[model samples]
Target chain A: MWFDILPSFWEGAKITIQLTLFSAVIAFFLAFLAGFGRLSKIKAVRFLAATYVEIFRGTSLFVQLFWIYFALPLFGIMLPKMLAGVLALSLNAGAYGSEIVRSTIISVPKGQTEAAIALNMTPWQRTWLVILPQALVMMLPAFGNLIIEMLKGTALVSLVTLADLTFVATVLNSSIMRPTEIFSVLLVIYFVISLPFTRGIRWIEHRLSAGRY
Target chain B: MSVPLKVIYNEESTKSIGNDLRKVAVQPIVNYSNISKSYGDLQVLRNIDLDIAPGEKVALIGPSGSGKTTLARLLMTLEEPTSGTIEVDGEMLWHQKTNGKLVKANEKHLHKVRGNIGMVFQHFNLFPHMTILRNVMEAPRNVLGLSKEEAMERAVTMLKQVGLANKIDAYPAQLSGGQKQRVAIARALVMRPKVMIFDEPTSALDPELVGEVLEVIKAIAAEGEMAMLLITHEMDFARDVADRILFFDQGRIIEQGSPKRIFNNPESERLQTFLSRFNRH
Candidate 1:
């Protein structure tokens, strides 16, 4: 049964890998935009960014995915399963990631901003040249955990019938009637796949955190 | 026996004398007109009208919370005044003439005016992620639009002047308090600002480290061309470096005169009590 299921699982794994990678990239970009927006001096920009974070974070990723996949067609805007899954994960993960970006940026000392200002730097230049670099160092530890959570969040894509790893594992269980072996194998596979990501994040965190307390 | 006196009219000395004459001809470099600052009805500074001449070294000394630091911050534009205007090098800092009408200065105008002033903070405030050389070079290259080579050369010279030339590649965390303050001075000097403000530059240092930072400041004062405003508690150091001392009390300049006069013949009871406390410490 394991042998028979290997090819199907491999196909599902490929989609899952692509989905997680694309969603994480998109989510990372969104997090920065939203995070900076929240800190923007302009009230409207701050409010809009805050709204995005709250709307996504206040609700369930499961419901969000289901809405885009199942309900949005009623409005004559049908999205492909993969697109819906990726969109849901990106928005959800980006919301949480924005807080990580914001808090880290805020935690950088007020003295840094004052020093930059005294140097006659414009607000944009100060943020770019001084504040962001230091904040990025502080964000790495929190960002590592967020990335791992994003990876785990990709598992939900299976529910929308995207034939992700979990979807394949479920199919195999129903067909083979070997629930114990198939489910255990599925669990082992997820842990195996997620191990390198966790290790990679730790490596990155270590590298970025040099000379930073 | 008598020692022969040789008269040497070196070009550098002549040029320095010419510069001094030029500085004297210009009006005050910084002028504060009826400046008042208040936070939620608690007045920090009150109707402070002052003029700092070119090449002048004015030290602000008073007891804590008497608004000495607030005055320095106002000059640096770190804190805005609730009323009145400030001018640096004859240009209004928070106000600008537009269409022959005075209007509140915008960001662009502030940046232009701010280029003429530099501030050395008590905490040093060096960019922790940058190397010492980068911290010194950043404003020159970015704000002043100097070429990388030019900025680096200026940074090296200023660092050498501060006696931290060897630590250019070092991080701020790797430096002692004295060394960090030196780097900050170098950073400000690289901008070649016409007005320099030192906001208790020695207050944050370890007692042993204060002398080294003050020595660098004294050297800068000795070669005075820029106007300097120092808010400091180091009374003796102030006497040594300052030509003029303003004694502040409860947000007002109670007595201001030559450092000798202020130190010796303090008029106000508040300043007298403050100086006595300072002497006891």
Candidate 2:
């Protein structure tokens, strides 16, 4: 019974990797834009970003899963459920990531902007050259921590019919009635994905804070 | 290179203002006419009509909350005036004259005008992400179109001038507050601004470290090219280095004159009291 799904675990692992990489990239870009929008001086931009964040962050991920997978067909815009799952997880997680990026940017000393202005740098130059670099360095450790959260978040995508690590475990458990074994293996898989991420965060945080290195 | 900044600072640019060699009448570099600024129903500056002559070293001194920083920000165009106009070299600063009517100048205009003015803040606003050399050279390379070699040369020389040559490769976090402020001063001076405004440049420094920065500023003041507008609480620095000192009180220039006239024979009781209790000694 366990052999029924052991042959497909590699396929599931591939999907998990693809989902993690794809969703991480999408979440990062969206989060950066959302963060910048949230901090924008223009009222319209700030409002739109704030509204998007609140909506994504406040709602349940399962509700988003159902809505994107099953509910959106009523609007005549049907997408494959796999795509829907990835989008749902990324967009939901992107909201929290946006806040992380925003806080990092805000934590950057205000003196940095004033210095750029006094040097006669255009606003765009200062953002790209001065502000973004510091913010990126600051955002890296938080992002490393987010990656583990994102790994767990991929589990939510399984509800929309994508055969990820959890889906494979569920299938094997049903076939063999060995729930304990399946669940324990799933725990190991999640641990394998998350442990390095935790260590990477510690390493990065240490490197950044260490002075004169 | 659209404007020959070198031409603006040539031998012909240095004409005496009557008998005073210390004062020059090159051109009306910055004219703030009836310029007033406020923040959320609080009027910070009232009907300011100040004309800074070319090569003038004006020190702005008053108690805290006297609108000195606001005025400095106004001249740097960091904040828009609530009313009236500012002109730099006969060109309207915030709004330009278009077809005989005043209209807002575009970003192009602001860039060109703001290019000519450099200011240093009291907090030494150095970019933390950059190395000290990069901080000094970024504007020169990006805005001034200086080649990497030329920018490096100018940056090194400016670093030497500010006595920060050894710490060029270090980040701001690695430097002392005094070192950071000197690097900031170097960053400003590298651009060769027509007007250099120092907003309490030494106010944040420890007493031991303040002298190095003040000495750098004093040397910059003596070089005789850039006009300096200084905001300082150092009474001796003001009395010794400032050519003219303007006393401000509650967002108004209550009195102004040479440093000796201000420190010795102050016309306003406000100035006398401000000087007596000032304990940064």
lDDT of 2 by residue, A1-213 (tens): 444545656777778877887888888988988999999999999999999899999997788878988889999979886788778878887898999999988888877777787777888987888888888888888898777778887887776668998888787777878887678777787788788889888988898879432
Best by DockQ: 1
After TM-score superposition, the amount by which residue B175's alpha carbon in candidate 1 deviates from its true location, in angstroms, is: 0.5
- List residue ranges in candidate 2 displaced over 4 A: A1-8, A41-43, B1-26, B278-281
Off by over 4 Å in 1: A1-7, A204-213, B1-26
Q: Which TM-score values does chain B get in all models?
A: 0.90, 0.90
* Residue clash pairs of candidate 2: none
Model 2 global lDDT (CA atoms, 0 to 1): 0.82
TM-score of chain A of each: 0.92, 0.93
Among all candidates shown, the one with the greatest TM-score: 1
Question: How well is each residue in B1-281 modelled by candidate 1, as lDDT tens digits?
Answer: 12122222211212223523422333667888899999997998999988776777889998889999899888777889999998887788998889979898898999999988899998989999999999999999999899999999999999999999999888998999999999999999889888899999998999999999999999998997877899999999999888678899889999887777787888888889889987886
- What TM-score, computed on C-alpha atoms, does each candidate reach? 0.93, 0.91
Candidate lDDT scores, in order, read 0.86, 0.82
The candidate maximizing lDDT is: 1
Candidate 1 yields a Cα-based lDDT of 0.86
Candidate 1: residue pairs that collide: none
User: How many Å off is the CA of B148 in candidate 1?
Assistant: 1.1
Interface RMSD of each: 1.2, 2.2
